[model samples]
Target chain A: MEAVLRCEGLVKRFDDRAAVDGVGFEIAAGETYGLLGPNGAGKTTTISMVCGLLKRDEGTVIVAGEPIDTSSVEERRAIGYVPQEIALYPDLTARENLRFFARLYGLSDRMDERVDEVLDVVGLTDRADDKAEEYSGGMQRRLNIGIGMLHEPDLLILDEPTVGVDPQSRNAILDSVAALGSLGMAVLYTTHYMEEAERLCDRIGIIDEGRIVAEGDRRELIGLIGEADTVTLQITGADGCAERVAAIEGVESAQLEGEELIIIAHNAGSLLSEILVVVRDAGATVKGVNVDEPDLEAVFLHLTGKALRD
Target chain B: MTTALLLARKDLVQRLRDRSFLILGIIAPFFVAYILSLVAGPVYDYGFSADYAISDETGSVGEGLAEGLVDSGFGAEVVGSEDAARALVDDGEASAAILIPAPSPVGDPPPIVVYGDLDDGTAVVVAESIAESIANQSDAVRVLITETGNPASVGAYLGQEPPVGWVQGDAGDKVLDGITYLSVGMAIFFLYFTVQASIINIVEERMNGTLQRLLMAPVGRGSILFGKTLSSSLTGLLSMVVLVVATTLVLGAAWGPVWGVALLSLAAVVNAMGLGALIGTYARNAEQASQFAGIVATVLAFIGGVFVPISTEPGLFDTLTRISPHRWLLDGFGANSGTGTVVDVLIPTLVVAGIGVLLGLLAFGRRSKLTGVV
Candidate 1:
């Protein structure tokens, strides 16, 4: 896959403080690459450098394979940035705000049409006539996102998009981000929420203390935790299903907790079907099933020997 | 969607929507005008002081002298004795005192003793005018020996001619023949000040997080800077328009031809706001920008002679005035009313614009560094 955004050896320092110290990453086309880190972990600083808002002290940020030089206007033109803060003018109505932004980008035709489409995507069509200041917190957040995508640039960078939003709005935003990924738009999504990263990102880079400590597919990161896989089954008709599950291929342990059976396996996927047969022979209804991998949180803790929040 | 037009539109709408803008744009200028009306016109207080006392015992001459001094606005009142008048002079209240000899002759010089005060500058003039008047009266009484001489025949001997010197609109001292340029220059001064404040929006926007939002738009810092400057220019121009009208009609000042002066005012507005943009970018907040603006505006006004003519030498102020936009505007006003030259007006216009462009570049260039708090 062609990498839409490529940053190498990016180092941004403020006086004596290294806000983003020697960081590097890339977001491929049609991928949601999350920059997962705690607060003050240089997530915002790194993103700012990539968006060309802050001149990096030392680095190379290439968007769509073209180098991003501050002297080059076209380089800036190809990038879209949704800041961590709400970026729209509150007093301006959504349509007016959109029109103003479109003009700023030097767009000529279809200004209204582009605004309508973004408003529709964020489900803010009904409230588009109102001033942005009058919108709910969630709606304002959505409008912030709307501004980011207005120009349809190759790389869309969102820095903590759902910071104070409600669950429904968060879900809507995450879903929109997923849709963007599917539409072949490269997205650089930064957040502290691990679940959001796990759910939406095709690849995840976990940053801490101004550095990307680890990055990979979900399982590859999970395997970095070195924890046993958890295989769970909701057996309906068997009395000794947990005992039978312990005897299946690759199963190392078993336990019965209430109506559920949990089998710990060294390699859980290899024995999952065999355990299902044993439960069926015992006449247990497999009403529900769950297979839990070692999550990114565990991987984070294993790599850093500390909780993600700490 | 041309960059300049787009920025101008955004700036226009934003400033129009601001309450502070409305106050500075409309209320503040008129308030200043109202205040100006209160203190406007020539400033003068005619005054006179006396150092003499005719004896109240005789009362008539004393009363006449007192009346003459009071009418000239030099506080004059009769004292009880010569000693009292002398005391008044010593105490600094009276600049001089005249002593009346007993049995004064009816048509003589009166042998009046004149005492003087050391510190008062006006005392000499008062004493001189009083002494001259007394001498003239004595001379007149002698001339009118009886009903022998007719007053018209005596008037021929006591003749006077009008003093000759330069006056503002007279044939000799008539450097400026009208109030047109002065009025236009005042209008430009205020219009420029208000418009300069309009560019304080950049600092306001940053403090309020509006700049952060603007940056997030695909708009970038350069565009935001341009937008703010455009708005400032428009408001400054609008203010000039209102000022020209207010000064011309309300204050009874003229600004020569309409079209040329209007264009001059418009260009001046752009230059003033361009400087305002530079100030706004460097200043941390609105208040700081305002403080800097005050000093800067005063300097610009001084250079331009908004308050007073910068120089008194012939062709000196007229030459140096080229450094200020106010001078350009004033010159344009003169040109239209057939008082000044295109060279005089146009040179200042270009100079003001050159300074404005330099300051504008400094402000906009600093903004790209992005140290503004989010």
Candidate 2:
């Protein structure tokens, strides 16, 4: 897939301190890339430079095969940036806000239809005429996201879109963003929520202290820490079940503790059926089964020497 | 430019929805002007009657002076003696007393004597004016008799008011009457806040984070700045138009020729927008901008003679008034009032607009700081 955005060697300095020093990343078409970091990890600064909102001290940004910078107004049409704050006019209605941004993006043709479509997508069609200030926090967040995707630019950038939203709205926003990837829209999302990144991102970049400390898919990242998935089985009669499960192929080890069998493997999910058959042959009836897969949180901690939330 | 227009349209819609334009631009100025008109009713009533006591020691000239006082709309009463006239003035029955001394034996006209009550300054001025007019007529008669060798033709020139027409000159020192001045002045004084409120919308957007979104749009920072300025200028212009029409209909203010008024109003609006932009450049947020704009507007209005005409004589305060855009606006309006042409206000309008342009340039030069752009 052709890359929708490619930025390299991005450096931004405020006086003597560098906010983003030599950061680089790329997102392909139909891919969702997440920049996972704690607060002040240079995520916003990187996004600002990518969106051409701030002047970069050094680097190059290429969007849709075109070089872009802070002064490149024409080239910016390919990019849509949603800042962390709700940047809509509070006094204007949701529809009006959408229309204003649409005009700003030069989407003059069929603007009303586009606005209505975005309102529907954000689940705000029912209250489109109401002022933004009158909406709930979640609704405002949805509207904020709605505006970012209103132009349907080649690349959509959302900077901590669900930072202050309720769980329900956050889920809705996540779902909305998850659906956009299926439409072949490249999305660049920044967040500290490990589960959000693990769930929605095709590839994740663990950024810390203005640098991409690690980047890979979930399994690839877990492989970096040499961590294995664990599968725990509760049995009614689990006599000698651990030894049988341990004898099975792909099962690294198994231990029996109070009618419970704990098995560890490189890929436990793939070996679950074979291990269950062996448990049945051992005359052990299974009561429950739980699998623990290593997630981005552990990877972030293993890589950065600190928790993701910290 | 199109993007700027679009942003300006959005701003105007927001302002209209909140009704800030209506409240600041129309209602407040009109309400204040109405209140001032009511409270300062007597100041606006230019028609007043003053009573004068006249003693004719020289029967010919004194009688002419008394007739002239009555003809000039003053109440004149003849008295038997100069002491009687003095008594009437002292007793507060008369505003002033005019006495023509007895003719000298040498045959030259004796110097006309006039006694005036110091308390009634208006009456004293009127009495002095009547005495002077009579003396001037006598002097003209004497000159005609000596030069032309004919006393008969001198009779035609006496007791006739000199021809006078209130033509507003290019100097721009002339002003409207009390009620009209108050109405126009209040509208313009409130215009600063109205326009500044719109300019401060930029700061408000920054505080609200919308400005960052605007900057992210595919528009130059200059476009955003121009958009904000366009909105402020349009709001200011609309406010002036509404106030002009409202005051004219409700308060009976005669704002002179249409073309001249329009030119001056456009200039004033531009001036207000320019100053507002300059103030906005230094303001970190809307509230701070509002405070700074208010202080500047109040100070300018005071020195510009919006509340009251500071002075008619040339002095320090009078010279200071020239520095204010409000003074130039008022001067333009005053020059344009009643039968005045555009030429009468051209200089003042240029000065006002020039100040606005200068301030606007200064603000534009600092656009990087204002918008945080490189």
Candidate 3:
């Protein structure tokens, strides 16, 4: 199936530095794609280019079937955008804010219905009558998302929506995004949080220093790191224990820092029992054992030699 | 256009909810206008009078001069001696003393001695004006006596029927009392604040990211700008109209024709909106925008005769009056009855509107350039 959103060779420069340099990605219909990076890693800049808020030095963003043109009302209408900041008018009630945006989006024919539906979708229907300024931060963020989704556009672009949100609210927002994908809405999500990408995105694009360093699904990305599993052992008096664990079968390498012995092994789950026996034989009292499966964080570390959050 | 209207409506609603707008834009102008009108007291006809003491030495000429001063709105008390007249003036009973000698014998005019305290400059000026009128009347009678081949006794005849008749009218029909002037002045002055608030709203949105969100919406940037400006202008126009009407109804302030007031109010709003847009476009942030807006509004208020009538000043100060829309608006409001025509009002009104349109276009162009939004 044709992709709902596609960007090719997007470049945006500020002064002499390229904030978003030759970036490109695509999101198919009903799929959730994420651009994961740290702060100042150009994720917001790239998202801004896609939303037509910033003029790209070079690129074309095709939304739905049409190419993105900031001046074209139709093209802009096809994409729902939720900025990182809560952009609603503080003095206006949530419903009023949604209605105003709905009207601006030319949904005047069913403004009330759309506003009500979006408010319900954001779980703010009960408190919709209160002014936005009276809302808690999480509720305000939810309202911001509701405004973006009001027009039911072909694609939704959320730029770090969960930033500065409480944990419960962040989970609620994540669940909403996952629900949106299940409902067949194409989503382009950008964030600095790695776990958000892992939990919500079907496909992840690791952006670093103005470029997409890696792009893949969870399995494919973790496969890039040679199928290694991390085994961490909390021990007591575990001096000279790393060598003992390294001699075990299926163990590739072992390192001990303080009382924690971490082992990188091939097929670590199958070799855990033998590895523990070796630790015990090495005169170490095992306090705790954790077998960490390959995940995006490991994949990111393998690809960039730095943590995903660095 | 629908988007523009929605945006305008949103701005209007926000402004309505803001209490500061209600106080500054609506209540304060009327309050200030009412206080100023009360301070202006009551209006009266064009006339001046000051008490003058007439001396005993002067005969008919002194009598005729005293009579002329009385006719010209001055109180005259004839005393037996100059000392008595001086005492009357010194005791604050009379304004001045007038001494008339006996009629000229050899066709030489008699010398008149007037005594009063020179410290009272206003009393002195009024006395001088009354004295000048009486002297002119006497000269006219002398000339008539020479020309008409009548006897030198023509002074008595002229005194009975003063040749120089006075027909004074109230200082034009347009009564510019304190209330009327202050009402319009405060309205126009606060109008700058209203328009500045609208521009600051734009700056705030830009700072807070709503501007970008709006740009990303289906609406065009022109529509957003147009909607925002229209709302601000309407807020100013409505606030001014409310203050004018309320003051006129409550305090009985005569602001001339309703249509004239409205047209000028609209023109003033346009001018303010344009200037506000320019300030908004030039400012880097909301704080800078509000600061620049306040400075511009205050400068215009001073130059436009808001605090004091700059037009009354001479030379460059009067010339600088035309630089601000406040001056034109005040001039437009000041026009009434026999003083000005509808055309007179429309010219200044149109000029203000023209300036607003020009500045608005410049602001729009500059906004597009600054944002690089095509």
Candidate 4:
């Protein structure tokens, strides 16, 4: 019943900039915990600490209920790492690379079988014999994940595993990750892409500025900014149409996307009247209107003014 | 497969894949071996062409010896007078002026007075040789004096015969035996170089991130390093065996018992590998490692008799070479010849093994630093 992977007060600083600061989170066995954040938001650094590739400045990492030590060759064995960068030897064929890693993990006898299994899972069975460098971006990413599965570890820690991958390859990777969860492997998936986090993770932890600002079920996180709603209007109004809407009560922020004046508000029912009054005073006509529910993207934008891509 | 062998095999394959390593490892040894044969023996001869104004003071015999030298072997000049001889030697027109004194019989037929600055080894050998030939002639005159059973007319000019009790342990074989040490020493020295090159590959792997991939694979860094050392040492030992056996069996040259010589060479390879790893670890990158390795290996090779014969090295310098792995390997190699034992072979082998492992451990510190050198 213990969390498959746990971090308490983990903080890693490089050059006086906190890459991971006092970050604490836990992912249960058979669950995919996504670390969602923008670039340089400490996701990779946090995962690096978890993988034992980098030491934390201050924190305690418990992998499968055992204390983590940088020197614990045993502790390292329990965690499977797919680094942000492709860490496999480019010169080695996928099968050969898998076998090499398998032997390193001390599983020499049945490596052929395991390599075949992972290659099939990653949809790379046909291309497993090709050198890794010759692989397309998506194939490389798939093979990168296949490397992690070679040992069939209990806890799989993938850091930005799908970055730079084509949509098809990325979708295939997400399916493989979901399959790992079904097999009871704990998954700590880190990515800045919101859709991937929303699709793959059971619980999402929103990390920004080296700290986990909020982490919970997707519905629960969206609930954090429940009052945030996007109201779009087809307004053929005067020059001050946006200004009038901006002054309306319950409207938190407003912006125009081409023909639509998208106003984010706390109350959709009352804000429509206030918006209509402002448009009439400006001698404008309000046409089609739409109100949308809040999403993870809305929640993130409210928490930090910067967009996810920023 | 055993863990170490599996790791070692993979390591060797990776190294072979590296184009630079493949070229250097396969080609460099043969290239060096070919060069050594060409440049091995004496390179320069100190013979002079001088104007001859011979007076032939000692009559036909002096003239006969001089003519015999010019015609058959030693390149010499027959000068007419002492002044001409002095001028020829002084004006840089000649390396020496052989001034044969009229035979002063009683002591040692007037010692051949061949004169020049004496620091040069080749010059010393040539001068001493000329003196010995002249004295041999004088001693013949002494023997004739005894045979005739008379107080000879030139008693004072007669030379004494060489002593009858000349001792021998190894002095008799010095000239001919140098070739033996040259072959053994060169083989030992090349193994040392190859070991350094092996370590450079390891350093290259580490710097290029290949080592990180290799290490992250369930294999420990220790296993990777151990594999490297084993393969590199094997490479060195194999080259020695090939060189030794090729020269001995195919070329009809002898290097001693195949087993003993092979064992000695093998031990030397391990020692070289350890030294190489230590140096490889010392540098942060392959280029730096190769540079440091090359310089250190060169000094060791030069000291170990890859170039100049060790016998000619200054006593202190020769003794200093004992600390080098090259020196120990050569010692073990030399011991393999001339009434060697299992203990003799074991001592050097043990030294190489012990020191190799020790240096390997010291080099392990570099690996420790690299875990987070970034």
Q: Point to the candidate with the largest lDDT.
A: 2
lDDT per model, in order?
A: 0.66, 0.79, 0.75, 0.66
Off by over 4 Å in 2: A248-250, B43-173, B220-222, B338-344
lDDT of 4 by residue, A1-310 (tens): 7798889999988888888889999888899999999998999888767776677789988988777755556667777877666766676788988888887787778888988999998899888889888998888877878888778787898888887788887888788888989988899999888888888999999999999999998777887876566788887745767876787767887776676788888756567777877777888777888988666777789788778889
Chain B superposition TM-score per model: 0.56, 0.69, 0.64, 0.59
Give per-residue lDDT, candidate 1, residue A287: 80
Q: Positional deviation of A116 in candidate 4, in angstroms?
A: 1.5
- Model 3 residue pairs with clashes: B58-B100
Docking quality class, candidate 1:
acceptable
iRMSD for each candidate structure, in the order shown = 3.6, 1.5, 1.8, 3.0
Q: Tell me how each candidate scores on DockQ against the true complex.
A: 0.25, 0.64, 0.51, 0.21
TM-score of each: 0.68, 0.82, 0.75, 0.65
lDDT of 4: 0.66
Which sections of candidate 3 miss by over 4 Å?
A225-227, A231-289, A293-310, B38-175, B311-314, B336-338, B369-374
Candidate 3 residue B51 C-alpha distance from true site, Å: 12
C-alpha lDDT (0 to 100) for residue B197 of candidate 4: 76
Candidate 1 local lDDT, residue A284: 87
Best by TM-score: 2
lDDT by residue (tens digit), candidate 2, A1-310: 7899999999999999898889888999899999999999999999988988789999999999998888888887888878898888999999989988998888889899999998988899999999999999989998998998988888999999999889998999898899888878899999999999998999988899888988888778889999998898889887777888899888889998887788899878888889989999999999999999998889989999999778
